[model samples]
Target: MALLTVKNLKKNYDGSPVIRGIDFSINKGTCVALLGPNGAGKTTTLRMLSGLIRSNGGSISFEGLDYQTDIRYHIGYLPQHPVFHSWMSGKEFLVYVARLANLDKKTAASRADELLARVGIADAKNKRIGKYSGGMKQRLGIAQAMIHQPKLLMLDEPVSALDPIGRREVLTLMEELKQETTLLFSTHILNDAEEVSDELLMMHNGEIVESGPMEKVREKHRVDKINVVLQEGFIPDEDLITALPSVIRTEVARGVHHIFVTDTKQARDELLQLIQAERWPLERFEVGRASLEDLFMKVVDS
Candidate 1:
């Protein structure tokens, strides 16, 4: 059963439609990522889902309750720009939030400490928010969001401010959290969504154009990719590649040509055979699995 359902959700800003009747659901104990380019309604959907903004039209139900009323308690939202109290220590800020959520003082302290440890910010528990780095702040944001153990977590651009190492840390943390909690976050970065998401909601032109389990979606919209680095420099004729049955085509850059094959196995064999026939010096070749980025590009571009 779905923990959250969004059906025919629509919204507008300044008389311009921003989210155009998108539909999807979030299952229990899964990560559903909202992916898109800028101005693709991802942020708008996130805001509406979290109750920060009312949708012009839609039904949002969570945990057997209407989202407008009974389900807020079960959802945690971390906005892109989280404004923590600068003067308050990380622990103190979390306790403050817990208190506002009606946690008793004793329970609040325990929750704060537990979450701080869970997000790996225990060492900085006493440090003020002003002193924390971008990654540290993101982790703290996640800690506070999960402190109450909400079943649904919504994080917007959670790793946008982090360096590569920090981004990996956040993704790892999200993966760990997925063992028990359902997460739906919005991000423009394809790799971030690809790394940690089980399902993807691909938004385009201010609407959710595609959505499904990530791997299933890729398979359904499969396009094979091949990258080759020829010894020295070799350029395969475009017509030769296009002549291959159902193969999309070929592209070359910096002495490396990439083939987009419609059939994965056929592309592999055909390319190898062609290489052998041409007696071309081969340096390196790679056949890649279908990727979320490919699916995403296909959807948004179409």
Candidate 2:
């Protein structure tokens, strides 16, 4: 079942529309990625859903509760650049957040301890926030977001600010968190989204241009292309390859030839036959599946 539903969601800034009547839903126990380039209004949409900003039009329903209701109670939001109280210890910060969530003092302390361990930062719980590394701070931020046991967790560009090690650490934590909550994280990093999400909402120009299961979306937008690589000092005749009946066009970049084709099977056969007849020096030939980057470029350009 859908844990959250958004219909005709719209947002405007000073007479300009930012979110233009976008619609989507999040199913329970699924990790959905909101993907787009920078300036795609990803942050704006998340803020609206988190109740940090009001939509100019449309409705947001969480578990059937209307937008007029205080749905923030059911949402845990971590902004891209989350501010931490550097003076406070990790455990102290969580306890303070938990208390704000209305947990009793004893429960707040207990919950803080539990979450610190859950996020794999129990050893650093007593350490000052200023002393924690980027990854540790992100983990702590996630823990704070979950303090109230929210049904939906929204992370805005969660790993965008981290180093390689920090990014991996937070990503691993996200993978684990998926088992426990319905996660909706926004990011422009296609690989990260592909790594952790089951569903995708591809936004562009403040609108959701495409959304569905990751595989399904890719299949629907699949491009017909073959990648060919030749050994050093060997180059295939581009005109010869493009003249094939099944081939449409060819492009070469960094010693790799990208052959766009009409039919993969026919193109493979024709290219192989030609290569054999002419004794062309071919190192590798691959039938390429459309990658997320490919799909993103196609959709955004369209």
Candidate 3:
């Protein structure tokens, strides 16, 4: 059964609509990603779902709960910029939020300790949040969100604000969290979504352009392309590859070449033959499915 469902969800500010009518659903124990560029209403949709804001139209249902009633108790939300009481220790902050979520004092304290350990911040639990780094803060935010064990956890651009190490830390935590509950997060980073999500919800111009299981969505809008990575200082002959009957288009960047082809099998055979004949040093050659980034661009451009 779907953990959450939405129909014709619409939101507006002033006289302009920020979210056009859209429909989507989430199932239990799945990690779903809401993907889009800036100002694409990713935050707005997440806000509405989190009950931080009211939708101007449409219905949002959580496990058969009526949309007209409060469903906030069934969800946990971490905004794009999660605010913290700088003076409060990490454990203190989580316990506070847990109490606000209606847990008793003892349960809240226990939950806070448990989550601190789960998010890999137990050692720093006594330290003031002001002293925590970006990655630590994000991990704490995630911990607080899961404190009440809400059926669905919603995060808006959760890992977008961190350095590489910080990003990796939160992503690794997210992978573990998804095993415990349903997760829905918004991000413009295709690689992050591709890495963790079971499904994807793509937005453009405030509407969901496409959404489904990650692989299914990619296949639906699949573009045939081969990615060739050459050894250092080696470059593919762009003109020669494009001249082939099976090749459609070519894109080169750094030391990699992306060749769009009509037939993957034929293209692979021909490209390998060309490379061998020319004795070019090849690092990697991959053909078939378009990457998440490539598929995302195609959806946006369409």
Q: List the RMSD of every prediction in angstroms.
A: 2.8, 2.4, 2.8
Best by lDDT: 2
lDDT of 1 by residue, 48-156 (tens): 9888899999877776675256566788889898889989999999999998777899999999999999899999999889999888999999988887788899999
Clashes of each: 0, 0, 0
Residue-level lDDT tens digits of model 2 in 133-162: 888888999999999889999999999999
Candidate 3 displacement at residue 125 in angstroms: 2.3
- Number of clashes in model 2? 0
Residue pairs that clash (backbone atoms under 3 angstroms), model 2: none
Can you give the TM-score per candidate against the true fold? 0.87, 0.90, 0.87
In model 1, where is the ten-residue run with the lowest total lDDT?
A: 63-72
The local distance difference test score of each candidate is 0.85, 0.92, 0.91
Which residue pairs in candidate 3 collide?
none
> What's the ranking of the predictions by lDDT, best on top?
2, 3, 1
Per-residue lDDT, model 3, residue 142, is: 92
**TM match of model 3 to true structure:** 0.87
Pick the winner on TM-score between candidates 2 and 3: 2
